[model samples]
Target: MIKNSTKVLVLCALALSLFNCSSDDDNDRGNWIERSVFDGVPRSNVVGFVIDELGYMGTGYDGDDYLVDFWQYNIAGDYWVQKADFPGTERSSATGFALDGLGYLGTGYDGVDELTDFWSYNPGSNSWTQKADFLGGVRQAAIGFGISGTGYIGTGYDGDNDRKDFYKYDPTSDTWSELVGFGGEKRRFGTTFTIGDKVYIGTGVSNGLYKTDFWEFDPSTEVFTSKLDLDEEDDYSITRSNAVGFTVDGLGYIVSGYNGGVLNSTWEYDPGTDEWEDITGLEGYSRQDALAFSTGTRAFVLLGRSGSLYLDDNYELFPQEDYDDED
Candidate 1:
């Protein structure tokens, strides 16, 4: 019953409405999505490493006690399965690194003492084997990374003091050799991750003050080069410790940690430009001592405390897009 021109105008109006909805969806595409919650006790200072497409997480301290249960998340299936218990003493503030298809964990604080024993996990057999003791002194809250077939560890609290001494482990020889010390101030509970062949380390508490100094370590030359500091005159830049750092699509990101108070701010670092840019933070409550790992195609943040309450919620970050809900 309508005229031809009237019908044309109605069609155009409908098309415009549909286009606007599509644009809104596109804007939220790269945001964080709630994923499967961790299938273990909620805890802080957890560690995670990726082997192929699967991520392994374990060994942290609940408010009541230290824990050693190990779990693996199948990224493709979006579920978690318990793995072999960590063979070391139940502890917290440990570090885990994946190397040559296996995972190595060591250097944590048991309830009674700081620990130096190290162990390696074999994913194929779901078993762990004792490795040479960490060359560094008994310590906790250290950082570890594997690169080009060798494992490196350094910079943690040795119970008596904060440490900067670095060490490298050659699995082929089952030996750890002390390397040059890290360039930054002696620190504990800092975050570390590798992009390409270089390892980046920064952001921690030392002498009652939180740090923002960032450094990149090249294994080939065994040198540490300073990167742009996280603290800036800009108010948006966040400097905190016990955060998680991971690399995705060749870019590195730091997310969620404590700086006097719990924090949820996120920052992206571009190695090409040696700069950092603040981005939308994660959704939900703020937290510290969380764990992050990349499954090549995606990066995940999971399980940390936010005061008296421990959290088991999990989130997947799309660093290329703005976060879904920013606080």
Candidate 2:
């Protein structure tokens, strides 16, 4: 039988200790913060790119229909503004890359047929102009990356077969030329990111199985080099397709997608050492076919499908910090 005063004092002490522990746990978490929700309808298989200081995302499938409406995001303002609709037919799984301050989007499946029509967007004018068709012909689910002032796109299903051929697009000349094919297996839905002059492409589905082999593309030499395999021996479990990737401060990160099921794991890639290390997964919904865009300082993960649901939320990541979600 303890006195009421003695019991009250013990409870107060316990509360104080818990508060201190909570504060310490928060400090250990990663710098991923939820930003304003995307203004567009919930969607997946979207395309995104950063131009100047702003980011643009559009052209994806919403559960029932293909989407063409485009939206621009102002990072500093934390808001989205709708721009003109994509001039091309409604489509999804399109590939896009930003080069020379302009964004290029092309090659996607449009419900009835795979398409190769290419389009360019100008942020300064908020207008889109059709560009030269992809030399790879009508295809969808390809990968695109920008490096050394040129845009490169390739590899996807062409209604009948998976492809590994690659092409280079010259904005200054408005031309597309064939380049060396990817070194890995023919794949679609792979994740790609460019750091300095090198581009990294990996983790996708081919034939009937998921692929974990990674490749590094050097624009200068126009060659594709294999990196450490994701399935070699280590615990490298960050394998999936329909995922998205972006680079911040020269480091690349791949976020949520589908393997045999919806995936929520996150991974970081180091180009200098050609190594990948697991990071904390996004605290938001686990999804696949999401859109990713990175400015010089920040990276974002947005719109995608989770099972039968479409998501329109956006998450920001500070790669330099540790990720702690338990708190």
Candidate 3:
């Protein structure tokens, strides 16, 4: 029989062990650390592109009005500064990409109608210049990325129908041209992340159905190859739209989006194995329409909305670190 003091000591040891185990379980995978809050109005569906380590974001709808205000984030310094306002009509859900050291933005909804006008930003002068409009007709919630010095935009809603078509923008010629052979289903709010030479595209909704098919686009060969479906694994819960995708240290991640409701779940994809692993999710409110900035070594997610609540908070991901809520 154990004495009361001995029982007390044993109980304390057991409690400590359990506490350590719980903490370990909580932090075994990825972790999110809160960062500096965004300085601009809290908004969602904002467009952004990275140029020389600086992230340029603009033209999103605050709950009350469409916004054309633009801001720049210095990734290394972890701060934001206002830039010249987007010279075009105020809009949200636009797409933007950086090509040849310049950033390009276009094609979104201006609250009343979908827009096709495109514009370019010159960081050197901190100014905006008009470019040829998007050739793919009016669209919003499309995917945009730059590869091998060229920019591509594809998959979104055009007023009445979801579109699967793609178009390439040649900054050298200041023109847009069609690129076919994307056999994926028509979608809107799809997400993409580039890993080395290939860009992976998936997720979105079409006709009220959440899409699961995934594909890889090789800009070098200009071919789309089917990849593992997002639902291939019995435990995979990666089918989400309006999420943000980014690559860090060669691994791709998709985080925070809406399915039937807002989500904070995060998933990491290994292109080499063609598999995804669940990871620690965003530590903030579950949100959709968030934006991500990947500086190759680090990634940050910021400025999205939950239901009617707009968010201006930001968080940086530590893919292999232990979770610490206190930051």
Candidate 4:
């Protein structure tokens, strides 16, 4: 029965348990870290999203009016909660995402009209549901991303033109279907993310220059592959358009804003190798139309407008890896 020296000691304990489980999966795939602060109350173009470690901001503009208010940030309790308010129409460069677990807001420019209207926030039912309107450019520095489960909006700038149409939004047939327009130039604000199902978009500003152009959408070959020209890190000054972008753990950040007012710095991109580094010994809150988001890996830069004031703050970025359990 079992006696070849106990089956060679049970095959040497299952080959040392599959070599220590791949040596802890190559020692946990390390190298990826960065952190920053300053996010107390600096409202600009805010509108956030991040379900899981929680991170949800709301409404924007405080230099005068425009701000329906709503907040909640507990990225491990760096704390900030004032949720509920922004149900629909109460604008500021609108656009937020998180389908499935619910959270959608759209278009922007309520400084009058440019709000293609779209709402759906149910942080477990705090309430708000209108959905399916932003088929593209309701206007206001637009640029959205949410792949796979679908929700791709595109380019913005509609006070005098500058938009490249590219809608998707298939909230289980809630509507919106235009895809394939954003080729660049008809711009507005910038930064988008998705990665696996392809979504990319990169630093922006159109007509007057300052665009690190970089497209990549591919909702199953809906096509949009450009890849690079992300202005090669010219250290963004103000090719302005209400900047805001997020993505951690896999790298990609673009904080603060105002090109005409002279950026506040905080750049860092690295789609594995697209590169755009600058973040080193940095700070925070020097914003512009803020409202960034990311899930567990962390990223949040809520509230904006730093030049003439108008903020409510909510910064929380987090990601610092250093693996090598003996690699």
Q: What are the models' TM-scores?
A: 0.88, 0.89, 0.95, 0.34
Which ten-residue region of model 4 has the weakest summed lDDT?
A: 28-37
Candidate 1 clash pair list: none
Better of 2 and 4 by lDDT: 2
Q: What TM-score does structure 4 among the candidates reach?
A: 0.34
User: What lDDT is reached at residue 144 by model 1?
Assistant: 92
- Per-residue alpha-carbon lDDT of candidate 2 for residues 1-327, written as tens digits (9 for 90 to 100): 578888999999999999989876654324577888946579999888998778899988998999899999998899989999999999999999898888999999899899999999998888999999999999999999888889999888888899889999999889999997567898889888888778888988997678878898889988889888877657888789988888888888889989888887888888888777777677688999998879857898988989999998888987668665642
* lDDT, model 2, position 272: 83
Q: Which prediction has the highest lDDT against the true structure?
A: 3
Regions of candidate 2 where Cα sits further than 4 Å from its true position = 1-29, 38-40, 324-327
What are the per-model numbers of colliding residue pairs? 0, 4, 0, 15
- Candidate 3, 24-108: lDDT as tens digits: 6675588888888856569999999888888889899889999999999988888889999999999999999888899999999
**What is the total number of backbone clashes in candidate 3?**
0
Compared with the true structure, all predictions reach lDDT values of 0.86, 0.86, 0.92, 0.68
- Residue 153 local lDDT, model 3: 96
Cα error, candidate 3, residue 276 (Å): 0.5
RMSD of each: 5.4, 3.8, 1.7, 17.5
CA displacement after TM-score superposition, residue 40 of candidate 1 (Å): 7.1
User: Tens digit of lDDT per residue, candidate 1, span 222-297?
Assistant: 9899887877547645678889998888988889998888988888788899877776677766899988978656
Q: Tens digit of lDDT per residue, candidate 4, span 1-327?
A: 569989999999999999999876643222323223344555577677777667777787766677777776777757667878986767887777876677787888878788888887888867777876786646877877666688777778777887777788888878888876567766778767665556677676787766756776777878787876756456533235567766776676666666666365666667768766654211344666767667737666655656776655444544354342321
Which of candidates 1 and 4 reaches a greater lDDT? Answer: 1
**True lDDT of residue 62, candidate 4:** 66
Worst 10-residue lDDT window, candidate 1: 22-31
